[model samples]
Target: MTGPRFTALAQSLPATVPFVGPEAQERAAHRPFAARLGANENGFGPSPKAIAAMAAAAGEAWKYGDPENHDLRAALAAEHGCRPENIIVGEGIDGLLGYLVRLTVEPGDRVVTSEGAYPTFNFHVAGYGGTLVKVPYRGDHEDPEALLAKAAEVAPKLLYIANPDNPMGSHHPGAAMAEMVARVPEGTLLILDEAYVELAPAGTAAPVDPDDPRVIRMRTFSKAHGLAGARVGYAIGAAPLIAAFDKVRNHFGMSRISQAGALAALGDKTWAAYMHRLVAASRDSLAEIARANGLTALPSATNFVAIDCGADGAFARRVLTELTAAGIFVRMPGVAPLDRCIRVSCGPEAELAAFAAALPGALARARQG
Candidate 1:
């Protein structure tokens, strides 16, 4: 053969990038975006302590991060009232999801997730040749009862649900989340993606015991901690399942500086609380901007707002195009119905001001088209 043959599954897959990031767009346009609000990145940035710690750790960059992530995992466990055995630190929730998928999913295995939930998670599912059964969102929220019903029927290996969900910014109260966790089908491990939980209102986290084997929770410093660039995340579950990550994860994937930064970020509790306030304030400002523009802003418990464009997906897309063209970067949902809204991430006032300035002209252009 002229070239080495790939696996049948790899050959069958499409060569597609699920997300075309803002940087790619900027490169095409030959200019930077006025407001980088598309990717749900925390514009507030990492805590001062984290930044300082990263700088301090830079001298030690020659050494690899701990394969075991010893001190960091221990701190996380203490924070969550769990033992160190229950946590596994990784590159990010995205990387951890890949490891989890590879560990549990074989060819032809089934997994369940909401239709338009986190695309990265879906990407991992597809990579492993797992059959994904998508449950539609009911009233802009992932339907717990429907997802559980399908899981019970199909008995899939894993089920995913994200609270304070991405793209839509809707959230279920802690009581509902607890109920969903309780209803997970027998033999199914629920993957609760709580990446944005820190920014959510009080009582958003479910009251599940840390040692619960039925569920594994993934969290990150990527959101309210403002450490998106650092790429640190962890999973909490029963000791046995947490231990299983060692079988597939890139043991030394985490950077030494990133580990130090994450540890410092955790130690700076006041910084986390301050970020919560800033994000909440930015959310309100975004909502106000939407309202002023004659759009409906959905309620949010996350660091972003999804503004309903008061029209169909076509109109919303036109508006998004105009916004992007006007030097403001924003993103909309990929699928229909949900695509009738555009998602805007929380940022400092200067960035939001740019967004606010561009929106009206963008709307005018969209209307003309």
Candidate 2:
């Protein structure tokens, strides 16, 4: 019997998972983690109103979701002061990123991104056979000037940057981002991932003309709204670019329950504020824990902190391993200099205490090794 034929790109790619989930780790270890802080998930959870909405929509789960995402889009547009045509909602930022890469990249097309930025975007680029030209991070932040220089040199189809960057939790001011936007070379589209913007300080989001074709900004309910599992994300850009998603997107991809939950979550301003306060407090606590343990917690505007381990990537890896062995789940960066620290997500006091209790032993054992 003959097998199904595979495309050249499919054959060329290696099987990989960009991030190994906490659940998979639990199964392998044959025990549940005492603290879940590795995945950057909001332990506070979705708004109560969102929970109610999802419960209300559960019976309607059999029905297919609206392909147009009309109500959600309208609500989002109202919130952003833009028309519905300027927004497109999808399964999540990851899915939207794939669609964007598919829309713009052809085989051998050039793409520019930081060396240790979001790896999933790089995964998508590889899947589509795009050639990625990566620049190193400037300190803990993505270097806007260096990225623009590379984009100008190669005229890449896509330039990717994550504000309040992940794995490091550093951010640039919105004005700086606006300046970067102005300098984007002609013929290149910028992919601005703002998944953490809701948790960041005021004025952290750049001002972009809704009709400007130079950039498309991706936002999600995953971080601040505590809807990570619900998987609802949206992109804002020029109407034409937004409309182009209709050409290749999954018409009914978003879950009906997820849509209901996200829509409700978006409207709960009080809940969002409470979460912001909770995350800020927990972040401070994490920093204090790091300080007590003789580590330096990087200043962060997001819901997580990167605690420098006072050594190289190997030592940080050992610390992480010891922490995981002690049942405190945490993660670190995958590349050097950046990887010299471990990333911990903000959570409730109980979970933070668990992390605090375990960190000292983890560090001591790592030091002994």
Candidate 3:
């Protein structure tokens, strides 16, 4: 029998994934991690109301989810002061990114993004045969000027920036982002990943008009609302651009339980505030732990902190290895300079305490090596 034919692009791609979950590590080691602090998940968890809603929705599992995502889109539009036509709710930001890439990128189309930023976006771009032009970050931040310059040079079909950036936990001010938006080249469509904005300080979200065709802002319940597993996310853009998603997206991909949970979560402002405070405290705790270890914890506006390992990428990797060995799950950046730090997700005091206890031993062993 003959094997099914694979496309040239599929054959050319490497057999690799962006991340390895902590569960995989636990299974490999035959032991569970003492603390789960990687993956940038909101360990503070979803709202109680959301939990109840999901429980209630469990009984309706037989029915397919609303393909249009009407109610959720309407709620999101009201929150953003835009019409429902301006929003597109999808499985999550990751899934929405894939759809966006499929719609805009033909084979060999150019795309621009920060080097060592979110790998998932790069994965989607590559899957669709887009050529990526990556620019290195300036210090710990994604340089808007650098990205803009490259776009002007390459005239890429897609451009991506993540505010309150991952792995480094650095952010550009909303005004700075607004300035960047104004300078986006004529044809390039900007993808602003705002997964962590709900946890960031006020004035951190760019004041972009929802009807602006040049950019699309992506938000997720995965971070602030602690609904990562639920896989609910939405995008805001001009009505026409938003409508384009209908062509390529998975219509019934969203789950009924997830939709109900997200709806309940959105209405729970009190729970959202509580998670914000909890995450802030957790960030402070992580900073203190890093300080005690003679490391520097970079200022963060998201639900994680990047603790510089006082050396190069190798040293940070050693530290991460030691932590994992000690059952404290954590992650680090994959590239140079930026990889000099380990990323830890914010969690309750108990989990953070486990991390604090393991850190000194991890540091000592890493230094010895």
Q: How much lDDT does each candidate structure score?
A: 0.92, 0.95, 0.94
Return the clash pairs for model 2, or none.
none
- Residue lDDT tens for model 3, 175-275: 88888889999999999999999999999999999898999999999999999999999999999999999998999999999999999999999999999
User: Whose lDDT is greatest here?
Assistant: 2
Q: How many backbone clashes does candidate 1 have?
A: 0
lDDT of 1 by residue, 126-207 (tens): 9999999999999888889999999998999999999878879998987888888788988899999999999999998877
Query: What are the candidates' C-alpha RMSDs?
Result: 1.0, 0.7, 0.7
Query: How do all models score by TM-score?
Result: 0.98, 0.99, 0.99
Look at candidate 2 and tell me the lDDT of residue 178: 81
**TM-score between candidate 2 and the true structure:** 0.99
lDDT (C-alpha) at residue 298 in model 2:
98
Backbone clashes under 3 angstroms, per model: 0, 0, 0
Residue-level error in angstroms, candidate 3, position 307: 0.4
Candidate 1 vs 2: which has more lDDT = 2
Alpha carbon deviation, residue 322, candidate 2 (Å): 0.9
Q: lDDT: which is higher, 2 or 3?
A: 2
